[model samples]
Target: MGRIGKTAAAALLVLALSACTGGTPDPASSPGPTAAPPATGAAPAAATDPAGQVSGEAVSLETGTDVGNGRPASSHDGLMVRRRMVIAVHPTPDADLGALRRQLDRVAAERGVLLSDISPDVLDPVVLEHVVPEVIVALPPEGTHEEADALAGLAFGPVGSFTGVEHVHVGSVLVHDLQFRIGSADPAALAETIASEGILSDALGNYSTSLDGGALTVGYTGPLLSDELVEAVREGMARGAGVGPGEVELAPRSATGEGVDLSAEPEPAETEGAHASGRDDSGH
Candidate 1:
């Protein structure tokens, strides 16, 4: 299968498994026309404009640094296995979308980057009033640092006549298949444990968790995925399931372009216990 098709198939498989296990449905699974909210959290009350649109400057996320202009810093390099760029554009209420799309197309073509998807901001209802637009672009894989840098430059750099660029994020796509062998444990409880631990929260990055049978698949895109972060997640899942940390297994795979593979067999997670005391050695 082609790249996009492969990615889609992998995602569908995960969804199908999630459905069988009675996991929460992904928003994408919902049918019919629906508006998409903001990619990040709610805009600060102080940052809202008269029209109820959050100012672009106020949407702060830890995913990518805000470099002046439309360009964000290069977030893909040797250390990163995969990367994707989410560019949130805040246009005027009456701005011409056709012209903006054309401008985006031109930029993508010029930079040789794939313009993956574009959608309206529906995550935040307030932002919907402003009709913010978000663009998703795929970056080069590992070993193509130069191409990744060029793409970042084009994205964050100036675009003709298109302004009000909110936030630009470039980060890794971290995918993991979590295996829990605990007997009769509730998936909901496990999910709540992971969420409450703040490992999958927006502060960590944009992430999703789906349960299929006894396995939980998590996908996140933002910043870097450190061993410490992964360990924390494992520990939380174990604690949530009422099992030892060693009982939970995590198999992780990262991608920079498109699609995710969640079918791969998971490996036993590292048992070194980076944060066994609920605190890093550095103490935050």
Candidate 2:
């Protein structure tokens, strides 16, 4: 499938799973199996905040709504499933945190979205440096095209100017099973290989490959990231570096970012045969 097709399929799968599970997956931790709830005619339960306040934010659209036979609800169904998203704001010369929060709150209220949490340090240190003054927003999941459109309007509309937003990301989950570290010995070459190999590039929309603490760290945004893709990246990196597969390790990451653009084509230098000069100068 093409990149857009693959991304759409992954998004559909995530929404389906969300509908079945009754919520979006926790980005911080993996979920364990659970027993089926006892059959009851009771109305679906509403989410409760520890503070006992509704918080007036758009919760998950899928919350408290169930589709029969464990099937996901159709986009036409007006169910709102709460999902997480992160917005990275560029720092301005005279940035005011309070004013920014108020601006964000006003925007959320206008759009009926809940501004769950806002933090400046939620991003990886590497990503944090480039897109400092960031904030993570947890609002309703975009299960339907309408929801997605609303979000795009919010991100790219008026608020875009306020945050000086770098990007908006949805449904980003950090992988824990796969971990890898690049040593000081060859961090640049290794990072270059990982970026150019097409394995990691194919699965991620916006990503950062940088050296942190004398080791290479990679952070990316996308919903399609899977164990299989992780393994493929590991294997490809191993081959490129002439190292054992075990040498590649995945690192723990927190979710962050907004508006994953899967349609973006990788730079020519980051694609296969990028190193080759077009001319066959060698004498035939």
Candidate 3:
């Protein structure tokens, strides 16, 4: 129905699918998707879809950049299609996001994530009027999960303050050292809420859930959260890893072997655009 409603519905779709297949039980005991229980005597099939399409969860994938001479250079093909969301960043007036912009660009290239809009030149601008890009897949290269997580944490700084929105739970996920960790919110509960409860959805709808065993195992590299939210993060990570909330073992330190502050980072300068710089009027 609405933007927030759509996001919420998407979340429900994830949880419902998990329950139908007995994937993961909701921690809150909320009603989830319903499907006939797997036949008692039947062996689990090769986990194939009718069309023989393999599920992403069953496969371990690593996306790479294409430096091709034969193919065209556009964001429409390859890993770009796998993207599911977009984040547009613009700079504030009298403040240049040059450093931050470069960091994002480098992170995107390194992680297999894509950068949708805005250019390098506009990164150091005075204002960004209107710019929105669809997000999909990791941008940073492989082997930098923690770094990517930290960047995601910073990227979601603005939206993190909202009451019902646990920005990290729905934001970017990172892969690191072959271990899965929740990188966004400090308290894993926020992620848990996002995973367990359809905090963003409306009743009576069909959607998909992305938090299967496969989604949870993805690791992250990022900054720490406030002391208050760290435990939530631990719980959230455990859930993502399929450990369940009750079975989680939250250490004082993070899976990345570091600490984080839950307090929000200093607000990015207020500019006219999503990027730290004002929006660009020049036609590209």
Best by TM-score: 2
Local error of candidate 1 at 174, Å? Answer: 10
lDDT ranking from best to worst? 2, 1, 3
State every prediction's TM-score relative to the real structure.
0.35, 0.37, 0.22
Report lDDT (CA) for all predictions. Answer: 0.35, 0.37, 0.27
**Residue lDDT tens for model 3, 217-254:** 22222211122223444454455445665444322212
Residue 98 accuracy (lDDT) in model 3: 56
Off by over 4 Å in 1: 1-80, 83-159, 163-184, 197-199, 254-284
In candidate 3, residue 135 scores what lDDT?
24
lDDT of 1 at 2: 23
Q: Model 3 misses residue 135 by how many Å?
A: 4.3
By lDDT, is 1 or 2 better?
2
